[model samples]
Each structure stands twice: as structure tokens, then as C-alpha cells.
Target: MAVIIKHNELEYAAKESAISEFALLTGKKQSGAEKHMKYDIRMLEAGRFSFPYHFHRNSEELFVILSGCAVLRTPTEFFEVHEGDVIFFEMGPDGAHQLYNHTAEPCRYLDLRTVSGLDVCEYPDSGKINILPEQEVYQTGDQVDYYQGEAQVRDKWPESVLEKSR
Candidate 1:
């Protein structure tokens, strides 16, 4: 089936935080796309940010500047993007990025990203980890070893169950 949603019909949802703010319209969902890729249209107001500076372990993203301009901050450098510009971000640490609208005018862009069953996003500046879909966010500094709490596993089982296994 083909789904066609006119740009003029897009209804955006607004969100704001201390440093971030945007009006977003989920293109993928509106089109009934269930897998593989996700896209959204976003409008970022001047002096606002798109998202936290982070990189995905399993997903790649692309941004198309539809109108106006913004400053893109990455791990190594910053870029001034304008209308008609397309930016691709690869997966992992090298792809860490965040966009800020530095201009006085509002900026609109299309954010397209590959979808995965599970994704881990690392925020280097804030020492935080975010698990997508699940919406689980944790501080990296509080991480524990895999086996840190697995001691005395045999004691957890009843003596009768252990004897049968032996």
C-alpha cells in the first residue's frame, strides 16, 4: 500500500526543556511505516537545541535542512548548515552530534534514522546511557560489572534441586 501525507497536513508536537526545544511531526508513524527506517520533521527555534549530544551504537541518522539554518556540533568539529543541506551521521562514537539553532529565525529539518530492535545511545558530556524504545536512561558512572551481583548462585537453588542435577 502507498501512503501519502501532504506536508501541509503535518501536525507537530511541541516539546521544551532548559536547553532543548522543538516541534516534531513523526513522518514514519503518520505514513504507517512499521520498520527499518524512521523519519521526522522538526522545527527548532532560535537559541534552542534539537537533542542532547549523543551517538547511537546501532543506528545511523541523516538530517536534511529544509529551511533556515543551524549549527551542528559533532565530536571533532562544528558545522553551519543551511537550507538544502544534507548531513549523514554514522553509528558509534564518531557520530556523536547535537544541533543548535543559532540564527534568529526558526529552522526546519527532516531527521531520518535507521531503526533497530535495540539501540544504545551514549552521552559523553553527561556520562549517561540511553536505551531507545525502552526509554531507560542511566548514568554511566553507576555501571557495575556483569557478574557483580551473581555471587552464590548455587545457594539460590534448593538442595533437592541441586542433588537431582548432580
Candidate 2:
């Protein structure tokens, strides 16, 4: 019953970034909408950072750029993708990937993802990890935090040792 008519659906804009054509107007009632799992379609404008770079442990994703151009970074390498191009990221075990619009013109794309039970995602840059509850990204911070060695005194052996080891 959750079907979106492409022609009837309005472009969704991103609230955080003005460079996007996705606002609240076209947002679906459900956060994750897809049969067999959660899926969403987003048409982004030019000069937008699609989303944060993260890896899904159990979910697979596909990015189809309909217009303009962007760059997709996988664990193994980076690729320059343009309109009519599609990128498939299999579930699990790849160096978490990211997509960005480095071009001056607007880039429109469709993002499709499927949920395979439970999953965890890692954000390499900010050192953040998200344990997805259903289809939501839960910011749980670093389960393991690293400490600086030189700043600690002698009694802080475990902490100091950990720092020194690094």
C-alpha cells in the first residue's frame, strides 16, 4: 500500500543543507519505506554531500544518479559517477563508502536500501558508531575510547599504557 508515484511525488529537500531540493514537503510518513525492508528515494541538488560516510553491517544500498555528477568512495577506491550511472554497495565487509557532490552543478540521485534484520554502522571520520534500531541511526558514541599517554601520570598505568601503545 506504500507506493509513491514518481510523477506525483514532489521533490524532497534537505533541511540541514540549502543545496538540497528535499525539504519536509515530500517526506514520506514512514522513515524507512520499502517492501522486504526499508527504502527511500531522494533527489538531491548540486553541491550537496549526499550523506555522511558510513558502513552498514547487514544492509545493502544502491545509488542511482539521474542527473549531474558526483563522486562515490568505496573501501577499495573512489569513482566519478554521473547521470544514468548506478553504484551498488553490497551488505557488510567493505570499507564503508560515501558520496559527495563536488561539481558546481546540481546532482539528482535515488538512494535505495534494504534492511536485513539488525545492523551497526560506523562513521570513520568523526569516530562515531551507530547501532541501528530498526531503521534509525542511534548515536551511541565510541564504544571504545582512546586516551592520550603523555598527559597522564604514573598511576594511570592502563590508560597510560594504552596511550603509549598507540
Q: Number of clashes in every candidate structure?
A: 0, 8
Residue lDDT tens for model 1, 7-82: 6776777753553354333333466555798878888878877778899999999999988999999999998999
**Model 2: per-residue lDDT, tens digit, 1-166?**
5555463454464546463532212234343445465545565445556557778777788877777787887777888998899887876657477777677776666677776666777776666666776445445562435554545565656776778877
Give residue 69's lDDT in candidate 2 (0 to 100).
83
The best candidate in terms of lDDT: 1
The reply for model 2, stretches above 4 Å from the true place, is: 1-4, 7-9, 15-33, 93-95, 134-166
* Model 2: residue 150 alpha-carbon error in angstroms: 31
TM-score of predicted model 1? 0.88
